[model samples]
Target: MDRALGLACSLQFLGLAGAMIPLPCASHAHVWAGECCPVFWGDGSPCGAATGRGRCQGVAGPGAPAGSDFRARWPSYFFRRLCACRGNYGGADCGECRHGWQGGSCQLRHVVLRRELASMSPGQRLAFVRSLDLAKRTLSRRYAIYASVNATPGAPLAFRRATVYNVAAYLHYLGSKTVGTPRGPNYAHRGPSFLTWHRMLNVHLEQEIRNITGDPSFFVANWAWQGRAACDVCTQQLFGASRPDGRLYPGSVFSSWRSYCTNDGPFTGNMSVICPLGNEMPITRLNGWNWDIPRSVFRGFPSWQDYYACLNLSQYDTPPYDANSRFSFRCALEGFIDPLSPADWGIHMHNAVHVLCGGTLLFSHQAANDPLFTSLHANVDKIFEYWRRRNPRSRYPRGQVPIGHGANDYLAGFIPVYTNEELFQHSVHFGYDYEYT
Candidate 1:
């Protein structure tokens, strides 16, 4: 029934806007594009690539107790007042709210709003990660309400437990400002591709895990490159294609070349394949951008799943943490607790935010500090949840998905690792919804 309605809507939309229009076509409000685009302005999306509209679902609230007023000010003051439109979907205020849509408050029920979770209080959010650490103790205990994830443990549920452990370690690392490689001054040096960020982050996680657990076995060993090798060596080796000079292969680790940084300014790497000029440019992935799941994965897939899962992995014992090693990786199979097949990447993204950032919404902060420091770690958790859920039944060739499940089942077997009750217990405080005028 929903499919039929969707089809009807698609047909109606097509009829109203010309059945077949070229990419980058400007419509009544938005500029349609086949290529990915990055969002500018002070919109609070992390790497705001053109994955979809900002979402409003997921956990909400303040990260700090008194910080609510400061946190609320952004949405209340700025978001409510929509920005003016700019060139080719570019705008000073990001596309304008259509007629009848109130701009004073960002709350346009029909439009997409920034859906974020808080992670202010590590002491509080850490419990969710701790549960996975102590999974053996809670295996039999039944809570009044279980996140759909608790139901399906998957065959050899220990693998799931292990996966959770891996996730926990990574989350703990992100939450703590522990020692790791720092983001450099040159944004291009960091290579702004989505996978680049993940790789850098994983490297940091691996180092932190080793520091804490004293086990190198917890790390996944992969080849490391320096200088020019950083750009295309992995892609050329993994896939038969070479990155055009100046076009950084953002998806080098991940099989797909679809980058969250694809649309965010000129990137340096191999660009002959994408650019006609073949200019050797430095890669750039700006703030406020994102990447959606690979399109091919969803074209021939299943139902809508509400639950989410988080994967955990441990590093293999080796030369401890390699300051020079460019790559270190591992894989984990994810199991969904629910049967719902995800229809859109947004669904997985929405739920993941809660798991990662939900608990830190309303913590007590000192002054005009940013909640994002807390919120960013939460976003990391949310992405991990999304990755685990998307792993079921589907095979993501490039990145890690545990051994047992098929690629398509990746999104299926995933269940929300954290529950509402657990979140409440771990939360420093809760966030109030933004009101629109």
Candidate 2:
């Protein structure tokens, strides 16, 4: 078992490194929407001529400052051509208006509200679940999944169709697997960028859901980890509950939901993958009754003091901004650098919630497969927002961050690719705020 686990870990590392390899095209190719005609490389043509919303331009590389932790690799030196959106025009091909703006000429401002899932009425919860299911079955109109990193442009089986929900889940999985250094683990997690990366991720999914459901009011629900402990919201009335026999109730919407991109095959295998078609599989518990591993006195929920301690931290993030550090906002919020000891037998805030949910949520690669992943992270973002409000002067690190987490570095696979610095103010830029009700 140990040997097999070791091999899987090794392959996952290799796959992660390969995925971060820059494609032959420029940085603009990283944007989604419309096909790129390579022949018109630097002519500065509009991405979508019909829209006339943006023109192609040279992509700028973030010249890492001296003494920076980021090396000149992948995103740091990923200089390429890209579309420069005009005014409020956005999207990879400059074919659509930016998030808050919507008009013939992209002149409007809108505010989106995100509420706690547990606070939602039964009707609202039902609608949210239905929207998620619809997203799972609906084919993505703008994007296609690449079969492999090595796939040639004209290869017959280079791309495959994917549902919007699957694409979101796959992006999360890929983000978790992306390695900054050839010899290290994923750069997306356990760093200053952890909250920022997830903030962008939730925004992306919320927009996708809005597009799919055609409801501009739709927002991802936040699950406040500090609010409860017993998985009270995991009921047939909300997200489904498991039967004594370890199966979802027949009447629950999630019972009919299927997971996508769940294959754990060797890294060398084809990347094009799909979810199995079937009824929702029951999320497994670690022990007979407890969903969390190493069950604690509070059943995986942190005490009020835990929340107080994290919220009271003064710095956004300290030096050596990785998980092992004892001084980072990222580590503090994640419960990694905490005051607790082994005698507590308890996990910290963000991780405790993942463990409490168990099954797919317990693993980084498969956590997003669970529909609840979005809401879970929403709450995490809320905590970050809370901390930010408390420490109004706290600023995101401008230098020495891991690759892809740098101030100007682009997040992989996002259209109109957002940099870490661009994502600093969630409500100001993304047009969304967390409502505590």
Candidate 3:
């Protein structure tokens, strides 16, 4: 059903936009000799020859674990060709330098710092909030969300324009929702890829914002979750606060901000028809102070001891790497495994913070609509980095990983697709690190 609907949308889009229209390429390079261009394919090699950055290579077939679940959605067999970037050169076609590295030859490494949101001064906080609002209105220059895909010859590729925030939301949906196979569970979450997937998402978002704002130093802010009950960043000064009547304050920048993709109907069946509705609604702010979730302690935030205990878990993830397992990185970092029982139900970290935020931030699908989502995830990423630093020898699951979370499996819906393994090194390879005060 999904494949057929996707084909129909592709045909319709082609009919309206002309069949011969070239498919979108991320490298900003023109189609070469009328061939369907894969990511990183520019001029000749997958990575263009501008600086001898990378070369085109064949993708390897799935090995071991035989018929693993990860291969269900993004069939690596179909996408057999890819660009292998060399040296510090990165990106889809080696067109741009890797994170932290810059200049013509891609030989510079500068510090990319992510700071706590509450620590920023009043002026800096105001600029950050305005930048987020601007990003909401700004259309992405390089990418578009394709509504459908038809690999057949001369088939039209159905696509729609999306704002910077909309793209982030779409990426989140694609990662969290089941795709490719019907009735399949989400591949990115409930497994080893949870942290890795979001890390890539943040990296992609940061790059987009940098392009939009033209500020190379811009980085997402983190929110400290332990022992803090109030949504300190949720104010007219930052993400915006609401009045007692449940409306945005008059002077808040987010007051005029609108949300996209509010409709959840298309997600149940074929995702090809899912496009940003662009339905503008008043920003919903459920401040932390007013709402209360059920917990043993009165304050919604987790105790510092609970956080330290999870951090001390030795294994990266336990057997059966799904959400149910305890003492694993996936469940521990997610704050789902009950610290009290170690195997039963408990919420202390990431999930607690989301529930405490309420409104759009509480729901996984709509969370990105609120700019605070970025800060929340940045802090989560910071926690993962902290764990990695503490256990320097521990590594991401390399063998026997679930289907969608495999080391080499391509992340769904991301252009210039990255594998989970490629994202294992948080700061060293990617060129960014977290700083806590």
Candidate topping TM-score: 3
Clashing pairs in 3: 40-46, 40-92, 69-403, 70-403, 70-404
* Residue-level error in angstroms, candidate 3, position 230: 1.8
Of candidate 3, the 10-residue stretch with the lowest lDDT total is: 13-22
How many clashes in each candidate?
Answer: 78, 0, 5
For every candidate in turn, the CA RMSD to the true structure comes to 26.1, 7.0, 6.3
lDDT of 1 by residue, 359-412 (tens): 221111100011122223333333333443444342223222211111221111
Model 3 error, position 136 (Å) = 1.4
lDDT of 2 by residue, 1-437 (tens): 00100001112111222221212232233322223422212234556544566666666445644331212233323224656777887765666677777766778876687898768897898899889888888987766553332323212222445778877776666666534332233545767778887888888778888888889899888877685646766777777787765456788777776555454343312223222223334444231235334444333566677777778767777666655556566776665555243223224777767666666676666677677788878888988887877787778887576666777766755555677777777564686887853
Q: Can you list the residue pairs that collide in candidate 2?
A: none
lDDT of 2 at 154: 18
Candidate 1 vs candidate 2: the TM-score winner is 2
lDDT of every model, 2 decimals: 0.21, 0.60, 0.63
What is the overall TM-score of model 3 with all chains considered together? Answer: 0.81
Off by over 4 Å in 3: 1-23, 26-46, 60-80, 148-157, 179-185, 245-247, 266-273, 276-280, 288-299, 398-400
